[model samples]
Target chain A: MTKKVLVLPGDGIGPEIVGQATRVLDALIENHGLDVTYESALVGGSSYDAHETPLTDEVLAQAKDADAILLGAVGGPKWEQYDISVRPEKALLKLRSELELFGNLRPAILYKQLADASSLKPELVSDLDVLIVRELTGGIYFGQPRGIRTLENGERQGYNTYVYSESEVERIAHVAFKAAMLRDKRVCSVDKANVLEATELWREVMDRVSKEYPEVELTHMYVDNAAMQLVRAPKQFDVMVTGNMFGDILSDCAAMLTGSIGMLPSASLDANGKGMYEPIHGSAPDIAGQNKANPLATILSVSMLLRHSFGEAELADKIDQAVSTVLDQGLRTADIHTDGDKLVSTTEMGDAVLAALA
Target chain B: MTKKVLVLPGDGIGPEIVGQATRVLDALIENHGLDVTYESALVGGSSYDAHETPLTDEVLAQAKDADAILLGAVGGPKWEQYDISVRPEKALLKLRSELELFGNLRPAILYKQLADASSLKPELVSDLDVLIVRELTGGIYFGQPRGIRTLENGERQGYNTYVYSESEVERIAHVAFKAAMLRDKRVCSVDKANVLEATELWREVMDRVSKEYPEVELTHMYVDNAAMQLVRAPKQFDVMVTGNMFGDILSDCAAMLTGSIGMLPSASLDANGKGMYEPIHGSAPDIAGQNKANPLATILSVSMLLRHSFGEAELADKIDQAVSTVLDQGLRTADIHTDGDKLVSTTEMGDAVLAALA
Candidate 1:
């Protein structure tokens, strides 16, 4: 019996890049003898177009039963006119919350081949690889008692609560330490412990949780200093764990350091390791159907889907190596292209990566 | 009547840098015929060492009485062992809260001469000069009911309040718009309105306040996106305004864009225009008496002190021009030095700027 993988080629450049990714998935199943079966489904704007909802119950059911999900980018200017409640982006939020995908893993890895593309000096980012494990289900984003109201003095006041429970922090800490165990064996938990008492609880929980993973070293940093250090020396970080809001800022900051924003893949996982993989870059509507979209990120998402959901780390390593080998051979997509690199169409680049995989 | 300017040389490199700044201050009083009177005081570690309190009543009284205050860098590793309440950093928070210094202005300026020093390409930051107006006295940092507590289930929880009143937002908005009027006439107000309802009120207040200064264009950005934009294209901004926590992060991110962290100055202002101007950088305990610490930031603080507090815009322009002239002449402080640039001692750098002023 084969495991089921639900493929959601979402919107704009979604179909183009994800189509290329599926080709690689097929090759793995046929040639590498991977025991996986895939199912394609409508999601995001397409699902909205067909069913008047961004995520239909039928699609949601299929997704719930699948072993893993591989989503391409979603949303574009075309859907900007829709109500926020029914917008295409609501699908992603819905998927995460419904699936209980609490840990969002964003890896900022600077391939040596794309070193010159970074904003920092090549020496600072050439070997950069940092994983940011963001607790997505809780924190200020979902904290209650948040709204604008009239005060006793007749002055209007805007207020929100930043709260974190011990269990919430502990679970995310376990995810981070588990990730670090596979890489550098170091996890730095970032929070505003000195200021935000919510994060003070987060820090305490992180320390308590680390006791369970003695192999992984844990360090702490204030959120503000963490932002500075990302700009100053991003490579110094191995794995950084933080709450939703801080992680959103720091992870994006870390992603830009790689200069391959279009090539980075991310994973959102549940406690049991059931996950959703996707490229960090958005659906580039302008370049849709042009065969100019970079497909490696989507292809890498397939690799992450394999390793994280199916526990096939060796298969994922092969895909990563194949992408690197193609880059080393000087094949370039328009986005990551520099002078003297061979410019290739999306299909051509995808083919080269597949050939290298073989 | 002379405007009383209080000079507080705080700790570590404070005295060395402040001494050079006073040379420029003396030149303005004598050569430029500026009607200014000066007084000296101790603060931070020096005050803690002398009075056992980081800020004394006598010094606070002098600060309140002075028309303007110019401060050098404060705090050092030597005072790291002090109790949290008496720590040197406590002096800053006390001063801001006591004086009701609600507005903090941090200017991130990238000189044409040192453009290569930036992590970004020279084209991105070459002409960058953004003033970040931070609301210092309000928001999460000072909000009430922030601490760890036990839940009904005996699990620990931590929490903080992020609250802002209309008046707090209005005053900072005015400071930003007014500052923009003096620059490129554009203000981008950053908030986390979409998720954090507190910022929804902030957005409302910013828009309401913008009506008062229609000449200064106002735009809005979510805090997370603003962080990305600061790195992506910092030059696109003229002035930015935000609350205490967001400002603390964005302002520091903007400062690093210039790669001149040692050469930036900041001013914290009260409602009446009485202000505390200081370098954005901290004291380097390692080079306290060696005269190796950069004094340009301190000198620049003198300029801000003149303009913001004394309304001596012409004298302030002169100081800015003098500093730029020295940089163009290839005179370098130890921190901002590159190959072929003349590495001048702190005093030499100050003297050259004064010579340029003449």
Candidate 2:
């Protein structure tokens, strides 16, 4: 079966990085015989410039028809003057909600070659691999009845609701357990059950869901302790699943643990295993077209797209190996370049990965 | 005029550590001529054992009347079977609400002597000092309309309101700025204003309050970015203020960056500067009576009590200097004792600090 991929090269350094990622995909198609056909479309600031909306109805319909979507970052200072509803970032929220992409997979992998870049002792973070499964499109970020209101005493108060349904918890839990099965077969659910009743229910749902995955060893941790443990001994965790807000905080913390955010990729998946893959790094507007942006994260997003959306794990492993081989060759992009390493431009780095893959 | 101090040695290692702290206080009162009188009480499991309640009315009255309170620690497995309403930890919550102690001050300080203990590189955390001022009495943890309910569709939904009034944010903001005035005069307010309306009001209040403390430089950061910044370069921050939940997570993360949990102290203050001070580490039931637990955090709590509650900065500095001198002399407790350091028991560590003070 030929899987369809939608590539949305967004604003800032998006076009340059996505160009490299697509080049890698082209090689996989021509040389490796990967069965995939991809089409390009404009979204975010680029789309706004073309159609006056961050995401067009046509582009959205195309996204729905695709097996996987690859996004090359979005939003920039140039689009800041636009109204919030039509902003470049709005396209992302619209896609997430429209597609019901509730499962967000963020992997924080510290390659041994770049361990010295971390503020942590090299021994603590070298070769560290942890996947955080976050329940997106739900929780406090989108809960309703949220706004500022005036009280009877003439004081202003603001409030937002943090809510989760049984089905929501169930689906996200399945995503986490299935992800754990593919890796370490251990999933630690993070919540604040001790204080918040909402998370008390979250913990209960997690326990109920754990009974279904007998092989996966499940544990629970308070959010505060989880934060400390991430800093103290990140290696102890294999998979961590949590609500949207906690996931937002912990995943970012875990990414920083690697100290190479430029090399991190993420995927947002729906119930049907269809996903949107992208680099965790934002579009660097400062160095937009200078060919200096790191494209490894975006390229890895292609690996995620293949492995998760297209069910091509072998191809994904090959892409990962090529990345490791490039690093072993002492090739470095500007963001990750240290002393005595060969600093390569965006195109050169992408070329090295393709050559290694070949 | 003599100031009254109430000491609550709650449970587990609490008694042993508080005993050591009182010994230092005796030195301060007798040798240093500190004009403060102290009394003792029981709380937590010990209190439940004696009075069938975690907090007695008489003790609560004493706490209310006291100029300051120093709590050692609380809770152990011995009281785990008790009802949630009568749990040992409830005593602390009762005191916090009753005393209106809405300002929680948690300091993460990595002394140069203990730099090797941190997971971060020595330069990143050596001599690192950051104070986290948390809004204690309000936010999602204590919000209204929170519970699990059956939806019309027969699915169970759990919800919690994350809320903050203008006055709540204002008071906490003042606490942060005032504390900043005493330190580096830089206050970074952490919130998710871009998403959470509750924190949006929080940011607005913080901005409004910043005008009164013109000497204190105030900035805003999203909670996710704050977590990352704490891991990447913790020293860049001087004082961080946030609502209860973010503070709970970020403060613990910052404390772990020092890699010495047994050496951190905390304080909870009210609008009037009256406060309760304690060690951030919990009661270690396994080492409760072994004389192996560390007393430095509790002793440091007394130092915080003197500075924040008693306004005795000179006396607090003296106590801090003594603790530093003892560490310089190569004394260590079981929790923080590395190879080649002279291992000291609870009482021995106390004697060393006293000797350093003398």
- Global CA lDDT of candidate 2, please? 0.95
TM-score of 1: 0.97
Estimate the TM-score of every prediction.
Answer: 0.97, 0.99
- Listed models, DockQ each: 0.70, 0.93
Q: What digit string (tens of lDDT, one per residue) describes model 1 on residues A1-358?
A: 6999999999999998999899999889999989999989999888888888899999889989999999998898988899998889999999999999999999999888898888777887896889999999999889877888899999999889888989889888888988888788999999988888898889888898999999988999998888888877788899999999899888888888787799899999999889999999999999988999999999998888887778888889999999999999999989998899999989999899889989
Pairs that clash in candidate 1: A198-B158, A198-B159
Task: Considering the true interface contacts (CA pairs under 8 Å between chains A and B), give the fraction that model 2 also has.
Answer: 0.93
The local distance difference test score of each candidate is 0.90, 0.95
Top-DockQ candidate index = 2
Report, for all candidates in order, the number of backbone clashes. 2, 0
How is the predicted docking of candidate 2 categorized under the CAPRI scheme? Answer: high
Model 2 residue A273 lDDT score: 92
Candidate 2 structure, TM-score to reference: 0.99
Runs in model 1 deviating more than 4 A are: none
